[model samples]
Target: MDQISGVQQYHQLFGTKVYDADTAFEFLTIAVFQAGMSWKVAASKIPVFKQVFANFDYHKIAMFDEPDLEAIESNSNMIQNGRKIRSVLQNAKAAVQLEPEFNNLADYFWSFKPDKSEEGDRDTIGAVVAKDMKKRGFEFVGPTTMGLLLVGMGIIERRPNA
Candidate 1:
């Protein structure tokens, strides 16, 4: 599939739904894993990821210790990237920290949604958000990852032909 359809399919499958902070974190985690791999490959691991990550509950994940990381890193069903696993833990901790300033991670992320008329470059907005997220202690959240995250969350519309 082309990029447009790929994004559309992803949005249709995962984004067209009401999402809480946990769900938002799930999508962000998917984006993290999507780096250096196809979305299909990354998506195929969602079930195992959900099972291992405590249903993407950032609170639970934030509390994960070394044993938890070791277990995940050793799991054959997971992507087996130690850095990505560690980043997930870091991102979870960052998400938990957002609870004080925002209602939840979802609230903090949705705050970046562009107005309908202001749907300019997705990469530009993604970069801005990525910068803020890095400052807030999230890991593995660069511009490209943030762009995919926004697309997966339906925070930004996908171009029909790009």
Candidate 2:
């Protein structure tokens, strides 16, 4: 396929190994961290994030001690914003807390969606941004960003087979 988009090209080139939710969750953490920054910058430093954050393990992040937080703050490859670093840790904690309440982090997250019926439609990708977001307590999760997140993390398959 002559890919029309960068992400599409990434999928075509990288294949489906990137489509797991755990990977998505980890990458989503990177995206959440990059909420206001450039994706190129975020993508460039993902290795640092992986090493410093213990591969985005919610169990570990939930148990992160002060030393871990300090280490994350001192890491040169990550965003040094103490607050953003803390947010990822906090979100990890939240993910852990959420796990017991559902099948998995992906289920808990997708449950926030009104329905999962149309998930296969790439053209409806923007529908992820529904009006119920604020009421659902999702802070930075908007439709477009969340959609990109689903793609990056492999939660949602890209076009053709999506």
Query: What is the alpha-carbon lDDT for the whole of candidate 2?
Result: 0.60
- Model 1 alpha-carbon miss at residue 159, Å: 0.9
TM-scores of the models, in the order given: 0.89, 0.67
* Clash number by candidate, in order: 0, 1
Q: On a 0 to 100 scale, what is the lDDT of residue 48 in model 1? A: 77
Question: Which digits, one per residue and each the tens of the lDDT, describe model 2 over residues 84-112?
Answer: 78767776766666556676666654554
Question: Which window of 10 residues has the lowest lDDT sum in candidate 1?
Answer: 1-10
The lDDT leader among the candidates is 1
Candidate 2: regions farther than 4 A off:
1-21, 110-139, 154-162
lDDT of 1 by residue, 1-162 (tens): 333443454446654543578878878888889889898877777777788899889999999999999999999989989999999999999999997799998888888888877675789889999999999999888898797677667788776663
List the pairs of residues colliding in candidate 2. 24-153
